[model samples]
Target: MRRTATGLLVVMAGLFGLARWMEPAYPAWSFVRAFAEAAMVGGMADWFAVTALFRHPLGIPIPHTAIIPNNKDRIAETLARFLRENFLTPIIVSRRMQRIDVAGAVGRFLADPVPGGRLRKGAGRLLADALEALDPERLGTMVRGGLVAQLRRLEVAPLIGQALAAAMTDGRHRPIIDTMILWADRTLDANQVLIRESVAKRAGSLLRWTGLDERLANAILDALHKLLAEMAADPDHPVRAKSEEGMAELAHRLQHDPELRAKVEHAKEEILDNPAISLWWQGVWEQARAGLLRAARSPDTAVAGFIGDGLRQLGDTLQREPRLAHTINRFARRATVGITTGYGDQIVRVVSETVRRWDTETLTGRLEQTVGRDLQYIRINGTLVGGLVGLLIHTFDTLI
Candidate 1:
C-alpha cells in the first residue's frame, strides 16, 4: 500500500512533467497539463502532512513536523487523560460492571466442575504452600504464645461452675451422683479386711481387751456399707439432695458472687503464669501441626476430603440461593467502584509513564508501522480530488 501510494505520487509528478512539455506543442493539451499540475501539488501536500505525523520531512526541521516523536510526552499525557476521563471514570466503569451478573457468573463458573476443581486445587496449593513455609518449631512457639494469651483471658472456675449448673438442670446430674455412690459402696466391699483392721486398730485397747473387737468391727463395716447402698438405691436420698443443692449454690456463686469470681480469676492467672503451661500448649500444637502436615500431603486424607466437600457445598449454595448471589454481586460492584474511583487516575498514568520511557525512535517506528498504510490511502484520495477540482476550474475559465 505504501509503495502504491508513493508510486501514484511519482506517476502524477511524471505526468505533470510530460503535460508541461506537451502544452507548448499543442494548446488543447492545456487541460491535461492543468489536471496533472494540481494532482501533483495535492499528492505532495498530503505526503508532507502524513510524514510530519511521524518524522521531519526529508530530515529537515519544520514547525509541528515530526509531531509524534517531538511531542511524545504531550501525546502520552493526552492519551492518558482521554482514557481516564472517558473510559476509566466511575460512571463508565460502573455502568460496564453493572451490565455483568457478577455472582451469577461466578455461580456458573463454580457449577461447572472443571473450574470448581481448578479453584479448589488452587486453594489447596496455597494452603500447602503456607504449611510448607512455616517452621514447625517456630509454629509451636507461636501457638504456645497464642494459647497462653487466650488462657489468660479465661476464668476456668466459672466455666466449670456454669457447666455443673447446666448439667444439674432437669435432674441431669442424678445419674452422676448415683454412679459416685455405687463406686463408693463397691470400694468398701472390696477392701473390707483392710477397713476392719484399720477400725480395729483405732478401736484402742478397750475393744481389744473385751475380745469383742472382731464382731464390733464387722457391725461397723456392715452399717457403713448399708448406708452407702441406701444412698445409691434412693435417688431422693438426703445426701443426693444436699449435693445437688451445694452444686446449685456453687453455680449461682460463680455466676453472681464477686468474691468467688475473684477466686476463679486468681486461679486462671496462676495457670497462665506457669512456665510449663506454655510448654504444654507448645507440645499440643506440635502434635497437631505434625498431623496437619501429614494430612496435607495425603490426597485421600479426611482433611482434604472435608475441604473438597466444603468447596462443593459453597458452589452449590451460590448456584441455589439468589439472595446470596445478589449480595455477593452487590459487594463486587461496590468494590469495583471504590477501586476505580480511588486509583483509576494512577492506573491510567501508567500508560503515559510507559510511553514516556519508550525510546523516541522505537516509538516513531511503531506508530508508523501501525498507521502508515492508512496514511497512504489519504494520498490517493488527495490526488483524485485535486484533479477533479482543477478540471472544474479550467472549464469555468474557458466558459468565461
Candidate 2:
C-alpha cells in the first residue's frame, strides 16, 4: 500500500515534468501541470503526516514527529487509565455481569455433550491436575489435624441441642421417633433367642418341663411387638408424648445444664483419645488417597463419567428450578463485581507495565500493522482530491 501510494506521487511528478516542458507549445498543458503540481503537494503532505506518526519525516529531527515512540510511556498510562475508568470499575463490571448469566452459561457448557466428550475430558484433566498437585500424605495429615482441632473447639452438646431444637420446631422429631420405633421392632426380632433364653432361666423347672416357659417367651415377644406397633401407629400415644417431653427436656439440658454438658464434653474427649479412632481415620485416609489416585490416573473414563453425570444433573436442576438458577446467577454477579472492585487497580497496573516494557520498534511495528493500511489510503485520497481541486482552480482562473 505504501509503495502504491508512493508510486502515484512519482507518476504525478513525471506528469508535471512532461506538462511543464510541453506548455511552451500548448496552453492546455498548463492545466495538466497545475493538477500534477497540486497532486504532488497533497501527496507529500499526507505522506509526511502518516510518517510523522511513526518516525521523523525524511529522517530529519522534526518537532511533533515520531509521536507514538516519543510518548510511549504517556500513551501506556493513558490507555491503562482509560481501561480502569471505563472498564474495570465496580459499576461497569456489575453492569456487564448483569447482562451475562454466568451460572446458566456454565450449566449449559457442562450439560452439552461435545464430540469425543471434550468438555468432560477437560474437566477430568483439570481435576486430575489439581489432585496431582496435592501430596496425599501431607493433605491427609493436615485434614486429620484440622478435624481434631475443630472437634476440640466444638461444643457438641450445644450443637446437638440446636439441631434438636430445629428438628422439633417443624415437627421433624416425629419421623425420628417413627424410625426409632421401627428399629426397636427389628431389634426384638433379632434378639428372640436371647429373650427365650432369659425366659427359660427365670422360669421354674416345672414350667420348663411342661413347655410353659416357651409360651411365656412368646407372650413377652408379642407384647413388646404390640407395644412398638402402638407407638408407631399412634402419634399421640402416652409413650410418644412422654418420649417427646423427655427429648424437649434433653434439648434444654444439653444447652443449659453445665453438668450434662461436661459429661458430653468428657465423652467427646474420650472418643478423641481412643487409639481405635486414630486407626480408623488412618485406614479411611489411606483408602481415600488410593481411590483418588486411581481415579486421577484414569479420570477421562472414571472421574469424568461421575463428574459429567453430576454436572448434567446440576444443569437439569438449574434448568428446572428458576429460583435456584437466579440465586446462582446473583452469587456469580456479586463475586465478579467483588473481583473487579478488589483487583481493578492491579489489573490496570499490569496493563500499563506491560505496555511500558515494550521497545519502540516493537510498539511501532504493532501499531503500524494495525492501522498503517488505512493511513496509506489517506495519502492516495489526498492526491486524487488535491488534483481535482487544482483542476477546478485552473478553470476558475481561466474564467476570470
Candidate 3:
C-alpha cells in the first residue's frame, strides 16, 4: 500500500513537471511552474532512493538495488553479530542493568502494599496452578522409585544398631526396661485367679500321683500364689535383673557383632520386599495427598495462612537486610551473566533459526504493519523537505 501510494505521488509530480516545462507562461504562471517542477524533481528523487532499498526503481537492474532480499542472509548474520558484540557484551549489559537499579525497583515494589498484594496473588495463583497440574500417581511412582527404593537398598541395620548401642551405653533404655517390668507385675497381679486355677490343676495331678487328698492340693495352690506375689512385689528380684541383663547383652551383640547386623539387615530387606510394605506406603501417600489437596482447596485453611505468612516474612527479610538483598542481587546478576556467557551462542542461534524458518513475505508484511505508518512519515517529510531544498537551489541558480 505504501509503495503504491509513493509510486502514484512520483508519477503525478513527473506529469506536473512535464506540463510546466512544455508550456511557456506569464510571470505569475512561470513562478508557479518553477515551484511545481522543483517539487516534482524532489518527489522523484526521494521515490528512487526509497525504491532502491527494497528493489530497483522502475524495474531497472541497478547495483545495490533490492539490497534486503538479495542480502537477507548477510543482514541476519550482521544483526546476530551486532547483538553478540554490543547488546550481549557483559560490560554493556551490566552497565545497562545497573543503571536500571533492579534491586531498588524491586524493593520499592515490595514496599508498596497494593503491588505487593497483587504480586502475592499472582504467585499464589501460579502455585495453585502448578499444584493442580501435578499428577499424584506419577509423583507417588517417582517417590517410590527414587527415594523409597534407594532407601530400601541402603544398609540401615548398621546405623540402627549403632544408635541402639549408644542408647544402651547412655542408659536411655533403662526406663523402657523398668516400664516393662512394671507392666509384667501388674499383669501377673491382675491374673491371680488364673494363676491359682493353674496351680490347683497341677496340684491335683501331683496328689493323684502321691495318693494325697484335696487339702494337699489346696496347700500347694496357696504356696504357688505366695511365690508369685513375692516375685511381683520385689523389684530387685532375680527375674528382673536377668531381663535387664538380657536386653543389655542383646544391644551389645547388635552393635559389635557382624552376624547380628546381617540378620537385622536380612529381616529389613524381607519386610521391604513384601507387597504389604508397598501397599502401606501407597496408602499413606494417598492419605497425605488427599489431606493436602483438601487444605489447598479450602479458602479459610491454615495452609493459605501459613503460605501468606511465609511470603510476608520473606518480603520483610529482603527489605530489612541489606547484605541479604545484595547477596540475592549479586547471585541473580551472576546467574544472568552465566546464562548469557554460557548459552549466548545458543540463544542467538535460536533467534536466527526461528527468523529463518518464518515466511519472508509474512515477516515483511508483519514488520511493515507494525512500523509502516512511521515509515510513511519519512516519505512525506522527504517530499516536503526536498521541495524546499529544490526551490532554494533554483532561486540561487537564477540569481547567480
Candidate 4:
C-alpha cells in the first residue's frame, strides 16, 4: 500500500516538474500542471484522512483523530449491545431453532451403523468409568436413603390387601385351592400305614387284640378319599363354597380391617428391620454393579446394543412421524429461547469484556492488516477523481 501511494506521488511530481520545464516551449503544459498539481493535493488529503482513523496524523493531537484507539470502549459496548439485541435475542434464537431439523439430523446420525457403534462404545466406557468411580459406602448410603424414603411413603398393608383382592378376583384362587387339596389327598393315601398305627394305638384293648384297627383305619381312609374326590369333582360342593367364602372374608378384612392392617404393617416393618434383608439388598447392588462393569467392558454388552438399536429405532420413527419431529422442534425451540433469554446479559458482557482486554497496539495492528489495503484503494480513487475535477476546472478557467 505504501509503495503504491509513493508511486502515484512520484508520478504526480514528475509530471509537474516536466510541465513546468515545458511550459515555455509548449502552451499545453498548463493543462498538465493543473491536473498533476491537483492530483498531488488530492492524494495527500486522502492519505491524511485514512491515517487519522487509526492515529493522529504526523503525531499531531487533533480533534476526533485516532478514532479507533480513542473510542475503543464505546465501540466495544455498541458492538456488544448490537449483537445481544439483534443476533442473540430470544426471538432470533427461537426462529433459528424452529428452522433447524434437530430430530431429523439426530435420526440420520443415529441410523448410521458406524457412528452408532462408536456412540455405544463411548457410552459403555463412560458408564464403566462412572461405576468404577463410585465409592461403595457412599453408594450404599445413597441407596439406603432412597429406599427409606420410598418405604416411608408406601402403605405396605393396603398395597398387599389390594394385591390379594386382585388375585382372588374371578375365581383365580380356586385353582390354587384345588392343587392344595389334591396334594393333601395324595398325602393321606400314601400315609395309610402311619394312620393305621395311630388308629391301633388309640383303639380299645379288644379292637387291638382282634386287629380290627386296620379295618377301622381302612374305613377312615376310604371316607377321606371319598370326601376329597367329591370336593374335586363337584364344583358346587359345600366345602368348596365355604373355603371361597372364607377367602372372600379374609380379602375384605385385609382391605378394610384396621386391626388386620396394623398387624400386617407391623410384620412388614419387622421384615424390613431384619439384618438379612439389608444384607440381601447390599448383595444385590454389589452383584448388579459387578455385572454392569463387566458388561460395560465387554463388547457383547446388552446396554450398549440396546442403546444403539434404540437410537436407530427412534431415528426411524422420527423420520416417519412428522408430528413427532414437530414436537421435538417445539421443545428444542423452547430450550434455545430459554437459554438465550436467561443468558443474554452474560453474552453481551462476554463480548465487551473480550474487547476490553485487547490492547490498542494489538487491536490497531489487526485492523490495519485486515483493511489497510482497501483504504489504500480509497486513496487512489480520491487522487484520480481530484485530478479529473481539477482538469475540468482548469479547462473551464482557460475557456472562460
lDDT of 1 by residue, 1-400 (tens): 8788789888888888888888888977888877877888888899899989988999999888999998999999999999999988878878888888887776665444453254545665676678779887887777777777787777676788778898888677888888888888888889989987887888869888886788887898889888888888787888778988987998889988989999889877887788887778777787777666665555344333665577567777887898998888878888998998999989889999999999999999888889888898998988878877887798789889
* Residue pairs with clashing backbones, model 3: none
What is candidate 1's CA lDDT for residue 164?
Answer: 84
| TM-score between model 1 and native | 0.52
* Candidate lDDT values, in order: 0.81, 0.90, 0.66, 0.84
| Candidate 4's TM-score | 0.53
Regions more than 4 Å wrong, model 1 = 21-29, 113-321
Write model 4 residue lDDT over 1-400, tens digit each, in one string. 8679868977988998999899899989899989998998899899889989899999999998899999889988999999998989987898788779998987776666453376767877999999889897678769877996788667777776676678778667878789978998999978988999899999999998898887999999999999999999987899988987887788788879999988887887887788988888888888888877887787344534885578678878888899998999889889888889889899899989888889998778888899999999888887888788889999999999
Summarize candidate 2's per-residue lDDT along 47-119 as a digit string, tens digits.
9999999999989999999999999999999999999999999999888888887767767765665645656
Q: What is the C-alpha local distance difference test score of candidate 1?
A: 0.81
Two-way lDDT contest, 2 vs 4, winner: 2
> lDDT of model 2 at residue 58?
88
Candidate that would win on lDDT: 2
Model 2 C-alpha lDDT versus the unseen true structure: 0.90
Per-residue CA lDDT of model 3 for 117-182, tens digit only, reads 545455555655666698978888787778766877777766766676787678776667666756
Index of the highest-TM-score prediction: 2
